[model samples]
Target: MTEGSLPRLELWCELQCPDCRTALDDVRALRERYGDALPIVLRHFPLEKHKHAYAAAEAAEEAFVQGRGWPFVEAVLARVTELERRGPELLVEVAGELGLDAEEVELALIDGRHTLAVDADQAEGKAIGVSGTPTYVVAGQRLDGGKSQQGLRERIVALLEG
Candidate 1:
């Protein structure tokens, strides 16, 4: 997509890391502050080292097919710590909590139905030069660091002002 068609802010993140969750929180705060003026796209870049990373990405995409992409993303980030301690089952539980059909989620996970979607996300992220979790692209500028809510808001405001 052209820069004009791109979101004011786009987030390339992985759900398997606690740091990503924190960064996502900052993104959420920026969304609240800027509303539609700031658009954020969540892209999955599952780290190969994280045992359940790819599986989690697949799960989120499955939820997307069910029209619950954002909720699934929020649930995963909210339960990042629990997911590390517990397991993938907790992700399914979160999906259930978010009103997704548990059976469909289970089937999707078992069959790897959304594997391609996750793979596509990974490929796109790599093409965009995302080398790690929580990479933020704001108005065509890449910020490769963890950002706080206020910090993100400031950056977004600056972009808009410019």
Candidate 2:
């Protein structure tokens, strides 16, 4: 796809904690505000400190394989606190909430079937200098910080107009 056809915003985040969820909320609002005019791609960048982050990322990739990536992501974000508190069971619950087959998601997590894809996301983020959660790449401009709705909207508008 050409530059104009590509997504206007791409977010690199981890779903293992509540901070990422907060960031995702802003992303969701931006999408609602811009509609199809702004595209946001979610990439997994699970941190090493979060015990279940890697597994959660694997589950998300499995969901992607099952064509439920976005839903899986939303589920994860919705239960970030639960995931941090209760762990993988929360991830499974989120999968079930998204109508994903729990057994398959579990299998994917156990089998390491999607580990490479998740790792690749992390590698790409590192390559692009993402050393933290909630990093955003907007029209080739990288913004590393927790951005509020107004802040994000302003940057996106500037990118679109520039």
Candidate 3:
């Protein structure tokens, strides 16, 4: 967050949360506006209430390792209901649809290779006072967008411009 350092946005999110899915709109808009100027990083913050959220987070990490992180996230977020209905199977299905190795995604989930990374993100998120999904940290500020995303994009813009 230093002055003249490249500004980054950390999105603490649960893949299964509906609010997090909605937050993707702002994420997409930011990507469209800033392109590579701004880096929007996704951090896992899977809430315990969501049954499949932890698995989804692990799957996302695997997708990231496979070089299709954002697209996999977007695709998974776009089908939250299906994810809730189908769990790990839905994760594998989405990976195949995106041309990723479906078997590898499944194995990663089962072997727990990405669990440590997801857990670390969750722990870091809690230490940073992230209490809910879709929370954003940018320019040393934490913006909670769980209930509303109003003025968030503007605030980020101001921080980036300031």
Candidate 4:
């Protein structure tokens, strides 16, 4: 099948949101079930409430540029509390642990090169009516998984199949 024929899931997420971390379970399941057939794209939507969220999003962009997008995302999401505590230091630490250049990660954060991309994602997310983290967009439908992910996977499956 051509890439355009595949179903895509855009996950509007905030790196510092614990709810986004929980939603990762659904992302993992989708990956395991559909693999390359499903395109699970991560969209940055840093909420104003989280002081470190914007920075984290930029750091994740750097990680993506360094070629470890999802892994870096998972690692940062796994430690939302520490991200809150340590701020940008936590980002550099995680990058180093993931074998990315820690100094380069720091420079990326400092230079703010990924700012526009992250900002664009946030703007597109808002344009799509995504007001919270953990929102899923699939098959032209918006699924709010911010509070509850109940039946979301099934809904996406139905859309993909139908």
Best lDDT goes to which candidate? 4
Q: What is the lDDT of candidate 4?
A: 0.91
For candidate 4, write residues 44-124 as lDDT tens digits.
999999999999999999899999989999999999999999999999999999999888889988999999999999999
User: Which residue pairs in candidate 2 collide?
Assistant: none
lDDT digits (tens) for residues 1-162 of candidate 2: 465554568788888756676777677777787778677787888899999898898988888888998878878878777787888788778888788898899888778888888889999999999987888888788877554434765776677557
User: After superposing candidate 1, which stretches have Cα over 4 Å from the reference?
Assistant: 1-6, 147-150
> What order do candidates take by lDDT, descending?
4, 3, 2, 1
Model 4 off-target regions past 4 Å? Answer: 1-4
Which order, best to worst by TM-score? Answer: 4, 3, 2, 1
Q: How much is the lDDT of residue 129 in candidate 2?
A: 93
Poorest stretch of ten by lDDT in candidate 4? 1-10
Using all chains and alpha carbons, the TM-scores for the candidates as numbered come to 0.83, 0.86, 0.95, 0.95
What is the lDDT of every predicted structure here? 0.77, 0.79, 0.90, 0.91
For candidate 3, write residues 59-144 as lDDT tens digits: 99999999998999999999999998999999999999999998999999999999889989999998989999899998789999
Q: Give the runs in model 2 whose Cα sits over 4 Å from its true position.
A: 1-7, 147-150
How far residue 69's Cα lies from its native spot in candidate 1, in Å, is: 2.2
Question: Which 10 consecutive positions of candidate 3 have the poorest summed lDDT?
Answer: 1-10
